[model samples]
Target: MKVLVTGGSGFIATWIRHQLLARGHTVLVMDHQDRRGGLLDGEEFFLGDVRDATAVTEAAAHADGIIHLAAVLGTQETISNPRPSAETNIIGSLNVFEAATQYRIPTVYAGVGNHFMRLQGTGCYTITKSAAEDLARMYNAYRDGGQVAIVRPVNAYGPGQSVAAPYGTSKVRKVMPAFTCRALTGTPIEVYGDGTQVSDCVYVEDVARVFVAALEHTACHGAPAQPIEVGPATSCTVLDIARLVADTAAEMTGRAPVDITHLPMRPGEVPNAVVRADTSTLDVLGADHGADSFVPLADGIRNTVRYYAEHWLPGYQLQAA
Candidate 1:
């Protein structure tokens, strides 16, 4: 199968591309710019944005399927400047849906799974992603539209994640990178609120497998398909993840464990919510259900810690110097 991966340069998309190639499918990556590293060496790529209807249509042409991961994501980023992010998250998704319907190809959409959270978080990101997920479900119901398998992931983190990157957005506050970076440097790890909010963090590779499985399922099923939620069995609270990162970093890098500090929650954000994951949906969809089979939080953190220690820490030290 020849797959055209939108937002192919992203953290999850990078892993999805690798997974596709491992399965013997030809990958054609289309992103706004080239932020990828040697992980995708020698792969076919094109510079395109999903916001452009013509570009999306042309890219989907002659492709077996599309896993649409393109979006302006980040809770704070979307909350501060919601327009551009809304345009990309909502309008950009419309473009993908139109292209897939016109070409009659299967598609898989990446949803934020905000609705499953308590109060749905009420941020611009939650609003836009929820709207897009609704649109995807509606598109699947359209007689003329093709199947769009929706997979909502919770805190998808792994090696490809960066603290700052292609958009120059500071992802340091995100759970994985924030704790890992601070602990690696023996700095105080800050936890927002009372550290009671929980998240079902899923490994990126497992999330990629769910997307691939959805693509295959949607390809064979009829219209109006179901949206699968992928998450780990072990859901961790803010404090749990913080302490875990501190321990992992101290053990791996031979550094002292960092102290944890609690701060008031940021504006435009909610607290004391649990992000649930229905990995059983993976069993329903017949995908590789990750919670039981793939890397859990402890090992996932080790991998993430190791990745940042090698790649990000060196650059960070150079910058500090």
Candidate 2:
């Protein structure tokens, strides 16, 4: 199968592209061409905007299916400038759907997640993604040959991901990088708002695998198509993650994570964003099942810290101690 992955240059999208190619499918990635780094091996990269119907149509013409992942994401970015968020998230989705129709593409899979659920304080981003998910549902019900599969992922973290990217956002940047950079130089880690707000962190590779599964599932091409959620469903509070990271770094580097217990929470942050996935729905769609497995928070953090220590610590814009 020839697949077009929108947002091909993104952290998760890059993994998705890699997975598709591993499965022996031809993959094409379409994005703004502004994101650094080139396409994954065995993938064709296109320079275009998702909001442009012509560009999307041309790029998706020869593809058998599409996994739409492009959008102006991240709450901090959206809350500050909602116009581009709407234009890219809402209107951009419309363009992908229209392009699929124009080219008679049979199976179009749409990616929708965290932002589609509760926004809490990030109304700007939540609003756009929620509307975009709704638009995908509309197309599934009304458009010709529309095989729209909506997959909502929780917080997906993994290697080769940049802190400056869209999903990482300024808010997440302040937290992850702040903690790791501090850990590197042996400084106290700041704890925001008692660090109790919970989050579900899924590995990006697993998220990408599910996407490929959705694309190949024949049951997803039917009427009243299924909308499935994927998650490890492991809820870890901010404090939990922080403690785990600190402990893991202590073990890995022979130095304890600094503990600074008083820090303010970011505005518009959710108290708890837990993901609930229906495994039965996935079975119904004939998706190959994988373990609802998750890496321990400490392990993930250790890996993340090791990455930043190698790449960012030497000369990045990370905050100085």
Candidate 3:
């Protein structure tokens, strides 16, 4: 099988490529050449942005499927930089859908997530992404060709994630990077707002698997997708997550216990922005791949912490060790 992944250098998209390649599938990645990182030495790459329709069209040619992971993420970042987000998430999505239509690809998978409903302060980002999700639905119905699946992933966490500004940056953006960075650095692990807002953190690997599963599901094949929510079955609060990270870090580093501080919640943020996954749709894809098949949450955090310790944070001085 041949596939094209947009924004293939992104944290999760890169993993999507990795998983597809592992399964013996040929993968073509289209992303901005100027972006800091490219795929590991051997991956096929097309240096282009999603908004460049001509470039996207050229890159997507002859591909059996298209995994659309290209978009502007982060609410605060979107508010700070709305133009690029709109250009990428909205206009860029249109280009992908149109390109898929032109190529008549059998399957087009677009990434969506709870951010549509969960993220508030970053209205610029959420609104645009939600609009992109609408485009996926419209393309499925109006375009009248190819299968369009919107995989709505929630709080995906794992290694190889970027920690730079405007990427994982957010006031209420207590997602994967926030939790992992805090745990790794022995920071206070501040839980923004009241610290009671609930969310489910999905392992990035599992999220990639969901994309592949949705792609392979016969029910989803040539059928209209109803925004499938992919993540762990249970949702935990921010405070719960901070506590878990503290405990996990303590175990991993044999460090003294640290306190979790509560800060003012960002405006427009939801208190319990939880999503109920319609497992029936996912079940059609395959057997019960049990919710936590990706990696245990604690184990995932430990691994992420290790990644930071050995790679990104290696040169930093130890905290009075």
Candidate 4:
């Protein structure tokens, strides 16, 4: 199978590319950024944006399947700049769906789990993602042969996860990388709103596996596509993750445990919510489900801490200096 992965340079997309290549499928990565450190030796690369209809269509022409992963994520970033969020998440997604429809290729969309529950705040990220989900559904409805499978992933974290490029905007860091970085540098892990908000943190590799499975699943092609929720069955509080990162970093770096500091909850931040994995979709697809077998949080955090400590910490120190 030849697969084209949009946003293939991203943290999770990189792992998905690797998994696809390992399974003997030719992988083509299409992203706006340069393909400098993202691709493996055998994979092909296409430098383009998902927002461009011509670029996306041309790239989709050469692939058997598409895994659409490109989007402007992060609550603060999307809330601060809703225009680009809508353009990329909603309009860009339409481009992918259009391309898939034109070429009659199956597409796996990367949806967010937050949209499944009641939103706590007025974040445009969720709004745009929900709109994109609807767009995928519309494509699935009218297309004769092209199918679109939506996968709503919970909080995903693991090694190789880092802050996204600035892309002419503020660099917004995800919680795991931010906490691990702070802990490694002896800075306090900042928690918002009493640190009780819960999330299901699935490992990046597991999330990648789900994407690959969805891409290869034959069931999505002939029926109305359903959104597959992917994550661990267990939920962890923000405080739990913070303490775990602190302890793991201290143990690995031989430093003191970093303190967890409380800060005012950011606008649109959920105070207390639980995200659980729904494995029914995975069961139907015959994919390895995260709900039954997810990487233990401690093991995942330990590996992530080691990765930042070894690969990212030196560069960070140099930049700080």
Estimated TM-score for each candidate: 0.92, 0.85, 0.88, 0.92
**For residues 1-321, what per-residue lDDT tens digits would candidate 2 score against the true structure?**
888888888778888888898989898888898543576667777789988888888888868888888877666667777798799888888888787766666444444445544445455667877787778778777877665667776666766666643323343363565666565666776776766666656667778887787777743444226666656646666677667666666666677666756676665565554444554555544535443454555566777878876776665544433
Q: 3 or 4: which has the higher lDDT?
A: 4
Cα lDDT for residue 278, candidate 1:
70
lDDT of 4 by residue, 46-115 (tens): 9999889999999999998899999998788777888988899999999999998898888889999888
Give me the runs in candidate 3 sitting further than 4 Å from their true place.
34-42, 115-122, 164-174, 218-220, 288-292, 318-321
Under the 3 Å rule for N, CA and C atoms, how many clashes does model 3 have?
2
Alpha-carbon local distance difference test for all models:
0.80, 0.68, 0.70, 0.82
Sort by lDDT, top down from the best = 4, 1, 3, 2
Model 2 lDDT at residue 182: 65
Q: Give lDDT tens digits, candidate 1, residues 1-321.
A: 788899888889988988888877788898998654443643677678889999999999858899999988777777778898788889999999899989888888898866654255566777887788888877777648667878888888888686754212564356788778888878888898988888768778888887877777777774324678888876778789888889999998787898999998886557787787776777766534546886878888899999989988887878777
Better of 1 and 3 by TM-score: 1
Candidate 1 stretches with Cα past 4 Å from truth are 35-42, 117-121, 165-172, 222-224
Clashing pairs in 4: none
Where in model 4 is the C-alpha error above 4 Å?
A: 36-38, 117-121, 164-170, 219-224
